[model samples]
Every structure is written in structure tokens, then in C-alpha cells.
Target: MTNKVIQRLGLLLAAGTGLWGQGSMTVTDAIRKAWVDQAGLKAGQAMVDSRKAEAEGYRDLRLPTLTLQAQGVRTNEPMMAFGIKLNQARIGMADFNPLVLNHPDAIGAYGGSAVLQQPLYTGGRITAARKAGDFMAQAEAASQERRKQETALAVVQAYFGAEVAEQALKWVGDTETWVKGMEDFVGARVNQGLMLESELQRLKAFHAQVDAQKAEVVMQIRSARSGLGLLLGQGPVDGALATPLEPGTPAPAAAPARRPDLVAAELQAKAAGEGAKAAKGNNLPEVGLELGAGTLHHSWSQKGDWTWAGVGVKWKVFSAPDLAKARAAKAQAQAAKDMQIFKEQQAEHETRVAREAVTAAEARYAAAKDALAAAEESRRLREARHKEGLAPLIEVLDAEAAVQGARTLILQSLYELRVSRASLDLATGTPIEGVQP
Candidate 1:
């Protein structure tokens, strides 16, 4: 079978496997498949989940914590020995004697306690931490959205690229067929002494050129298929264009805040600001309520249970390290804010550029369509004139070449137009499904 026939069979198989349809894969379907198959998108979603889990952990800090602890020790030191006895309610007059206390025999002490601590005040540290966690989660969520958009755009480019390559290959094949017919016609004329042998040779050379062009286009089609397959997390696939290029109106300019990347950047800055607040909390006093119930034993023979409750205050009056950390956090927050502003500006610029590209591509595609029509009409006239012996074979060949060139331009311009539209949708923060044409 010819390579063209084999390629067609491959496309049919691809369609049967649901990678694409008879018309080729639609942009919507491509985007949907990519969302489900793309490993990068899955990883992005996992990161969002991780951030959500971290946020939940931070939020849990507001609840009281209960802990159980146990310790055992054997000591002969006077102070420790006496304290153990006292805790066990086993103290005696001998423990008060200086010599007896100083040279007391070692005694084993064991203690188990359960304590509950409730934070009454943390100088807004917990609140700030929770806010930071929430902001971080939001940032991750935004980042995941951006990743989806990017994946959709990539699918658009690859899908259309394959379509254009397929069309170009078809054009080359048709040109080759036409040239072959011309060669046969000219060879008969030469045999009849009505055409020169040089005419047949020229036709043969044109056929060779068309064959070379066809080979290159075949490779391009394979490469395009490979790219699309990679984006869909599959092996190389072959398909045809399911939908024609229909350039739609450009999307209106959207605020930078609507862009997922810009939103993520803004959230990151907010998280950084919360981090600064949490760091400053280190300089303030922390207060909490602590309650404990425990039993102490001396030699396992004497034991007593006791309950105690108290309010605790912790203050870091002067810590150089904490001060430096707070300052660093403030600087980081400032930097994050600056980055957010820059991202907003960049988003706007990108959107504007994408809009311009779409406009230009649409215009080029329109012009190419018109040129193809004119070229096709001219080729028909030239071929008719050649049949009537009123035009030279060379003129007919030139018209055929013009027709093929116009077809090539049409395919390329259509590809560019579709890709530019996808880019504009991405820059405008429009969902893939919502992107028309």
C-alpha cells in the first residue's frame, strides 16, 4: 500500500479507538482528554490537596490539646530524694536531718501526668498562621487552574498542528496525482511529435519535488501526532480535522485579577503578609490555661494523686534571633507584594499581545482563503485552455503549483488562527470549554 493509504488507515484506527473522530478531534474533546490524562495537571491538583491539608492542620491549633507524659528516675541527691518523698507523701523526720539527707540512699520515683492546655491568647499568632495557611491553599488552587489553562492551550496547538500537517500532505498528494497525469499526457504528445521530450522531463522533475514535499509533510504529521499524544498521555495518534477553522470575535480585555497566575501571585503575597504578622507575634507575650492530674510513687509502696490548674505566661522580652526573623519576614512580604504587582502588569501585557496575534492570524487566514479560491479558478481555466491546445503545458503546470501553494498557505494560516485564539482564551482566563471557535 502507498504511504498515503497507510496514513489514512492509521487515522481510521485512531478514530475507532476514540482518540479522534472522522472529522478529527474537536478542541473541546482534546481539552477534556488532556485534563483527565495529563500528569502535570494531576500533580497540580495533588499540590492543591496538600495545601488544603496543611491549612486544616493549622486551623486545628485553635482547639485545646491533651497530652499524657510519664517519667521514672532513681537519685540519691538530698534535694531530689526529699522532693520525691514529698511528692509521694512519704516524707519523714529523717529527710530533714542534714547528714541523713546529704547521704540518703537512692530511691526510685515514678510519675505519670495528663495535662490539657488551652490557648487563651497567642498574640494573634494562631490566627495569623491560619490566615497564611488559607491563603497558601488559595494560591495552590489558583496555580492548579492556571495549569489546566496551559494544558488546554498546548492541546490546541498540537491538535491544530496535526490537522494542518494532514491537510498539507493531502495537498501534496493531489498535486502529485495531477502532475502524474500531465506527465502521461505530455509523453503521448512527444511520441506523436506534438510535444518536446523536455516537457516530460520538466513534469518528471516537478513530480519529484512534490514527492519530496510529501515526505517532509509526512514527517511533520508524525511529529505533530506525537506531540498531541504526549499531551493526552497516550502513544502517537493520527487523525483528521473534525472542525473547520472558524475565527470568532476576540475576547474583551479582562482584569489581571481574573488571570489564574495573577490571582495566585496575589494570594502568595497575602500569605506572606500573614507570615509577617505571625513572626511579629513572637515579640508579644503568650498566655494559656494548663490543667494537670497525676500520681507520684516512691518505691511503688507510697503514692498520692494531685490535681492542679494554673494560667501560664510566656514572654520573649529580648531575642535577637526572633527580631531578625520578624524583620526578614517583613522584607519577604514586601518582595511578594512587588512580585504580585509585576505579575499583574505582565498578565495585562500578555493578554494584549495575544489579542493582537489573534487579530493578525484571522486576517491572514481570510486572505489565504480568498487566494486559494482565486488560484483554484485560475488552475481550472489554465487546464481547460491546455486541453484546447490554446495554452502551453508549462502554464498549466505553473497554475497547478500556484494552487498547491495557496492551499499550503490556507492550512498554515488556519493553524495559526486557531492557535492564536486558544492563546487569547488563556490570556483572558477563559475556561477551555468557554472558548468559542
Candidate 2:
């Protein structure tokens, strides 16, 4: 019996430590790990990269384009044969004869050409296109940052959720231990004929109830840990989480900063405006320079070569389709500006609500602390009174229940406070709990 009691005590000790024995991680560490591992964040980063590449492509439109062409052709038709011979510089005085020109023999020529085209001006079309692309890329980058912040917020919830479950399990274990001691005491009283047998039976029933509650808490702990693991981009984690579920320092009171999503919306609006400008630019004149060099050879040893350079200008003058496009672009720009305004307002509302939530959580935590203290003292008094036969067994059990309730409330309030702080950080575009990258 002595060995059994010692072993049970040791097991309880191990359970307490085992909740966090495998590894330790701070909230900051978990967020950083999630940022690197989370699939959603990775996808968002890919989108940002794609947008940046597109922007580079748009910017490269200002660079000249060079093209190379090669072809071989044979023809017996008079005009085509004569043209090929002229281009190949194989035409002779006899080739100019009307009779020979009308009935030319089949001839084959191999031709290769290199052409370079440089845009001299296109009104503001290229400039606006490049600017629009740059702005859109910036918007995507901002949106990605917002995604990271959201992922961090999720990590906070999962990390602390596991901690809360583990902490609650420890408390439930304490309740179980207390109920067991009561059962033993009551059993001894009934054996001595001092307390009714029914009283001992009641204590045994309450001990069993506590044991059931402990089992439920254990299941909760496992579930919470599994959820945390999934959020970390790993499957179920067997290692104990290092961060404890507890209240921390409150966030400094301040006005909310511009959130990343809001910035993205603003940038998107700017991009749309630039797109409108680019669309209108399409109606203006375009000027360019073209350079060409080519060679035609009937035989490699005897080839003809030519080079030419020229400037060209083209004007749409009046195209109904181009006019409609410009009008549609203008409308789209207006719509984007409106959407940006709406997003700013929405962001402001979210920040205000998050601040209120933090305030409410703080108040709840303070009240819970007071209730926990009173409930603990009340339980102590009831237990002491019951020992002296001043209080009934039921009253002692009720007191234990009250203490348990108060402790649970305290834990819940602490969890809420921590979550509210993180929520506020997210709303204000702050790093989660001020954790820096």
C-alpha cells in the first residue's frame, strides 16, 4: 500500500510536467515557424512573386525587340521567279527579256532576315502600362503581408488553445485528487460508525464523477494539441508545447495604424487609375523606329544582302472600339476608387471593435481573479468545517464545485485576454503581440 501511494503521487507529478515536458516554444517562435511552414502563406508568396514578374515584363516593353527570320522558296511563275532572282542579285540582262520573264525556269532562293523594332513614342501608353503593373505588384505584396498577419493570428489561437486545454487538465487532476482524499476519509468514518454509510457512498460517487471529468479534460488536451499541430503545417504533434496558456502584458494603448489590406486596396485603386490612363493612351499616335538587314542566296558563294532603317508613325484617328474602351476604363477606375474607400472604412470599424474586445477581456480577467480567490477561501472553510462535523458532506462537495468553477472562469478569462490582445494587434496591422520578423 505504501509503494502504491508513492507511485500514484509520482504519476501525478509526471502528468503535471508531461504537459510541457517534450519541448518549449514561445508564442513568437510558433508564429515564426508557422509563417515559414503554412501552405496558405506559401501560396500567397507565390502570388506576390508572379505579380512582380509580370511587372518586370511590363517594364521591359520599353526595350527594343529583335527578330530573326529564315525561309527557302522555289517558283516557276514569271513575277515570283523574276523577283527572287532580282533579290538574290542573280538577274542578268537576258532575265529582263519579256520572253524569258514570261517563261522563267524554276529557281530556289534561301533568305534570312534580322529586324529590330524600337518604340520611339506611344503617347503615354507604355508608361501608364508600366506604372499600372508596378502598382498592382505593390498591391499584391501588401496583400501577402496581410495574409502573413492573418496566419500569425491563427497560430496564436492554436498555440494558446493547446495551452489552455493542458492547464485545465492540470486543474481537473487536482480536483480528482481532492475528491479521492475525501472518499478515503468518509470511508474511514463509516467504518467507525461515526458517519452514515450513505455519506461514504456519496463521496465515492463524487470521486467517480471527478474521474470522468478528468478523462474529458484529457481528451480536450489531445484535441487542442492536434489542432495546434495542424495549424503549424505539421500533422498531429506528439511533442508538448512549451508556451503556457496565461495572460501576458497588455498592449500599449494607441490609435490603429494602416493595415496591410487597406494599403493593398489603395494601391489597387491607383493601379486601376493607371490602367485607365493606359487605355486612353491607346487612342493616341504611336511612333517607332525599325531597322532591317537581310540576304538572299541562290548559292552560298553568291549572295545578295540589304539593310534598311526607317521611322513610322500611326494614329488611330477615330475608332469606335477604342473610344468605348477608354470610357469603360474610366468607369473601372471610378469603381476601384470607391472600393478603396469602403475598405478603409471597414478596417477602421474592425480596429475599433478589437479595441473594445481587449477592454472587455481585461475586465473579465480581473473579475475572475477575485472570484477565484473567494471560492478557494470558501472551499477551505467548508472542508475545515466538515472535518469537525459542523458542515454536511453536500456543502463540502458544493464548495469544491464552486472553486472549480471559479478556476475555470479564471482560465477562460486569461485565454480571452490573450486572444483579444492578438486580435487588436491584427486589426491595427501590428505584428502579432509585437513579435517582429
Candidate 3:
């Protein structure tokens, strides 16, 4: 049978075995599955959730705090004994005698108090802290988005890689079958005295080479499938193509405004700036109001109740550590700003490169398609000439090889074009759903 017939038969057998049947997976479906099942993406989302919870906790600082406490003491010290009596409202005029004060008896007392504290002012420290929490939460959200885009890019590459490898394997298998048929034809001609034994030997050697190439292509397909499976959180998978391999739509003229990583960097820089502000606020005074209601009893027979309200102020008049910390925070903020600028520049460069790659890939794919058509025409003409005794068998074999090589190039270019489009989407931070491929 002719090589084309054999290849068709092989495809029929493959289909019967379900390789290209209903079990096929589309690239879009694979990406959707990975988005739902990928462990790395899940972990990133969890981190965002954790940061959001932390930010919510920080925002609670604007509310009042309440505390309850109980205490007991017994001492012969004059100060402790007098204070205990005063708290229990059990102090007597005679208890002020110098003799009792000099040698006071041991006294036991128990007290409990419920206190509420409300911050009145914190030199903007509280506000800065809340803002920092918000910024950090934004940063985490951006990071999660970055992770999602990365995962989508990874899926696109792997899906295309698997498709490329599958096509290579199929092409190589077809070429191998064609070489085997040539070897048998040459062997028969040699036996019939129409071809030399050396020609048949050469054909056999070429057949062996094709076989080895087929083996390599098989391995490539296997490896590609394994990698794609891992990315999809499946151990391994094998199937025929469900999505057509083609170059996607070109990117828009203007790049996307918010690449995930750049957004994350900007938010992180803002968070750092807020932290610096909070650090500086450490040197300023803080004011708060404290309200308490309590009961104290020196004995079962004696008890007293009291309520107090007061304003409190705390000022760090001078502290070397606080100054150093403020300086360090400012330096960190500066570093973050510099990093953000660098990231922005890098992103712009990457977007430009990816756009160029897409253009180049489109050109290459068009060229490869033309070359494949030309090679097939050459192969058909050479085969016809050989059948008519106008061309040598070697010339026919060479033309066939050229056709196979051109087909391989076409396959590669097609997949490369797809990959370049994916890269462009990634560079621009286009959402996965926005990716045409």
C-alpha cells in the first residue's frame, strides 16, 4: 500500500482506539480545569484570603477596647495596708495614727474592675496602620492575580506543546511507514534484477534512520503529555487534538494598563510608604480615654464600689531606637519605590518583545505553509517521474524527505505562533478569558 493509504489506515485505527474520539480535550477546557484544580493557584487564593482577614482585624483598631480584671493582696507594709483600706472604703480616722502607720497589721483585700479604653488621637499612627493594612491587602490581591495569569500562561504553553509533539509524532510515524514501503519496493526490484543490491541497502539504512526519528518523536509526545497532565493536576494523559492549532488574534495597539506584577509592586510600595508614616508617628504623642467601674472588699462585712473616668497621654520624648526605626522605614519605602519603577520598565520591555515575537511568528508560519505546499508538489512530481523511469528512486526519496521536513516546519511554526500569542497576552497582563487562543 502507498504511504498515504497506510497513514490513513493508521489514523482509522487510532480513531477506533478512541484517541481522536469523544475523549479528546480542548485547550479551553484544560485551562478551565487547571484554574479550578491547580494546587498553586489554590494556595495563592488562600493567601489573599488570609491577608484580607488580617486587614479586617487591623481596621477594628478604630473601636473601643474593654477589659475585666481581678486582684488580691496582703501585706504588713503601711502603704499597702492603707491603700487596701482606701480601695475598700474601710479606712477609719484612727488608722492614721503614727503608731498604726509605723507598724501596720497584715491586711487582705480583693478587687475587680471593668475598664474601657477609647483612643482619642494617635498622631495619625492608627490611620496609617489602617491604610497600610488596606495597601497590603491590595498587594496580596494583585499577587493572586499574578499567580492566575502565570497559571494561564503555563497552561497555554503546555497545551500547545502537547499538540505540537502529537503532530510531530504523527508525521514521523507517517514518514516511517513511507520509508518502510520504499525499502520493500527497492528490495523487490533488487531481487528482480531491476535495482542494485546497494540501492536496497541504502533504502534499508534510511528506513532505520526514520525508525529512530519516530522513536524520538514518540518520546517527545509522551513527555509533552505528561507535562501537560501535571499542569492540569492530572498525573498523565493521552488524547488527540480537540482544539485547532492556529495563530490567535493580534494584541491591541496599547498595552494593558495593569499587569498583575506591576500592580502588586505598586501596592507594596504604597504599603511601605504607609509603614514609614506610621513609624514616624511613633515619636508623636498618643491620647486616649479610660473609663472603669470596680468593686473592692477588705472582708465579707466590708465592701465598696467606685467609678472613674480619665484621659491618658503617652509621648516618647526621646528615643534613639524610635528615630532609627523611622529612618529605616523611610529607606525601605525608597527601596520599594525604586523597585516599582524597575518593574514598570521591565514590563514595558517584555510587552514590546512579545509583540515583536508575535509578528515574527506570523511571518514564519506563512512562509512555512508556502514551503509545505511547494514540498508536497515536488514530492508528487518526483514520484511520478520515478514511476515513468524519468527520475531516479534516490531523487524520489529526497523529495519525500523534503516534504516531511517542510511539514515538520509548518507544524512547529503553527504552534510557535500560538505560543507567541500567549506570550503577548501574558506580557500585557490580559486576562485569561481575553486570550483569543
> How good is model 3 by TM-score?
0.86
Superposed by TM-score, candidate 2 places the C-alpha of residue 290 at a distance from the truth, in angstroms, of 0.5
The local lDDT score (0 to 100) that residue 244 gets in candidate 2 is: 59
TM per candidate: 0.86, 0.89, 0.86
lDDT of 3 by residue, 27-102 (tens): 6777777777878888888999998998898799889999999988788998888887888898899999999988
TM-score of 1: 0.86
Reference-based lDDT, each prediction: 0.79, 0.80, 0.78
- Misplaced by over 4 Å in model 2 are 1-22, 96-103, 238-244, 251-257
Q: What does the lDDT come to for candidate 3?
A: 0.78
Which candidate would rank higher by TM-score, 1 or 2?
A: 2
Model 3 clash count equals 0
Ranked candidates (TM-score, high to low): 2, 1, 3
Question: What would the TM-score be for candidate 2 when compared with the true structure?
Answer: 0.89
Best by TM-score: 2
Residue-pair clashes per candidate, as listed?
2, 1, 0
| Candidate 1 per-residue C-alpha lDDT over 97-165 given as tens digits, one digit per residue, 9 for 90 to 100 | 888877998888898999999999998999999999999999999888888888887777776666666
